[model samples]
Target chain A: SQTIHQWPATLVQPVGSPLSLECTVEGTSNPNLYWYRQAAGRGLQLLFYSVGIGQISSEVPQNLSASRPQDRQFILSSKKLLLSDSGFYLCAWNPSGRKTQYFGPGTRLLVL
Target chain B: AQSVSQHNHHVILSEAASLELGCNYSYGGTVNLFWYVQYPGQHLQLLLKYFSGDPLVKGIKGFEAEFIKSKFSFNLRKPSVQWSDTAEYFCAVSYGSTLGRLYFGRGTQLTVWP
Candidate 1:
């Protein structure tokens, strides 16, 4: 069975501070990874997706960026955080060419 | 662009009551539909999916959904609800045979009262 892990389940960051959220998947290789953010009581907004290592596609332009450093490791980072950057972030993985996705426990970020 | 719509924002039902949540999509070509459930403080889990063959598909926890192509709708159904079933349900769609990406609905928050 495959499992996705995310670090710092909840984070509190000061405005203008740098931020990084890491996601790693075990038991799968060359999986498609995605980053999504959900505002309070709202729908998910796709931030970025990667089909392979060092290949990332941005769905929307924002303060965040994503990187696939390894086949099973994905990282979401920001040089400087904004108040608007606060939200529930989710990381998901799907095997290549598969339609179904498995999600990791989300990271709740709060900027104060 | 493809989009998904979930009609109900929130629904409160009593335990043992029938459950039905409406989901609609706006895509002309072939598409794949899925229903995902997110328990409080948990990640999203696939409940059911409709690709081909039978229009009605059964999923975990006695949940089911029917895909009506002509109506452009895929509605989720559960014969009875339980307190443990309270969670947020999302409906998603992908264009054609390619998984490419998923367009998700706003989601429906279902609360089953004991």
Candidate 2:
């Protein structure tokens, strides 16, 4: 079975601080990875997606970025955090040949 | 560009009441539809999906959704909802030609009272 894992279930960061959130998938290779953010009971907003290592497509301009260094490892980072950056961040993956997306336990970020 | 829409923002129903949530998508080509549930304090889980063949798809916990191509709607239905069914439901769509990136709707929050 495929599973996705994300670290730091909850985070509190100060303004202008650096941030990094990691996501890793098990039982799958060359999967499509995505980053999404949900603001307090709102719909998900796509942040970034990667098809392969070093290849990324960002959906919106923001204070964050994403990277895929390994086949199943994805990272979301920000050089300087903003108060508006606090939200529920989700990481998801879809197997190479399927449309069903598997989601990981999200990271709740609180920027002060 | 493809987009998804869920009609209900919030619904309150008593236990054993019938439940239906509306979802619609706008896409020119073939698309795959999905419904996901997120219980309070939990991650999102797939409830059901529609790839092809049957217009009606059954999901876990006695939930089902019907896909109407002409209407561009995939409405979720349950004969009798339980109090435990209180959760937020999301509708998503992936264009057949896209790279499996799903476009999600605003979502509908369902609250079932005891």
Candidate 3:
């Protein structure tokens, strides 16, 4: 069975600080990876998606950015964090040519 | 703009009560619909999906949704509710033209009293 993992289940960062959230998938290769932010009432917003290594697509313009260093490893980063950047971040993966997505546990980042 | 809409923001019901959540979309062309559940401090889990064929599709945990193309609505239904059913539900849609993007609604918070 395939499983997705995310690091720093919870995070507390100061404003203007750098941030890094990692996501890795097991039992799958060349999968489509996505980054989403779940706000209080806005539901989940797609931030970035990657179909392959070094190929990332941004769905919305924001303070965050995403990268696919390895085939199954995805990273979400920010040079300087903002108060509005605080939210629940989720990483999801789906096989190529498939629409169903499997999500990770998520990282709750609180920017103070 | 093309988007997914969940009419109810929050719903509170008693145990054994029926469950009905409305989800509507305003996109043209072939689209895929999905319902996902998120418990407290948990990630979203797929509840059900509709692609083609039967209009009514059953999902895990006794949850079912019917897709009505004419109405552009995909409503979720459950005959009985349990306290464990207290969670947030999200509706998402993906158009055929958009290959790797999914449009999600604002989510409905379901609170079931025991």
The model with the greatest lDDT is 3
Worst lDDT run of 10 residues, candidate 3 chain A, spans A37-46
Kindly list the per-residue Cα lDDT of model 3 for residues B29-97, writing each as its tens digit: 898999999999887899999998999999999999999999999999999999999999999998876
Ranking of all predicted structures according to TM-score, beginning with the best and ending with the worst? 3, 1, 2
Q: How high is the lDDT of residue B15 in model 3? A: 100
DockQ of 3: 0.76
Candidate 1 chain B: minimum summed lDDT over ten consecutive residues — where?
B94-103
**What's the distance in Å from true for residue B7, model 2?**
1.5
| Residue pairs in candidate 3 whose N, alpha carbon or C atoms collide under 3 angstroms | none
In model 1, the clashing pairs are none
Tell the DockQ for candidate 2.
0.72
Q: How do the residues B1-114 of candidate 2 rate in per-residue lDDT, one tens digit apiece?
A: 677889899999999999999998997579899999999998899999999999999999999999999999999999999999999999999888888888999999999999
Query: Candidate 2, residues A20-85: lDDT per residue as tens digits?
Result: 999999998899999999997678888999989999999999899999989999999999999999
Model 1: per-residue lDDT, tens digit, A12-109?
99999999999999998999999989898777878899999999999999899999989999999999999999999999989999888888999999
DockQ of each: 0.66, 0.72, 0.76
Error of 3 at A32 (Å): 0.3
Predicted complex 1: CAPRI docking category: medium
Candidate 3 or 2, higher DockQ: 3
Model 3 agreement with the true structure over A2-112: per-residue lDDT tens digits: 999999999999999999999999999999999999876797999999999999999899899999999999999999999999999999999998988889999999999
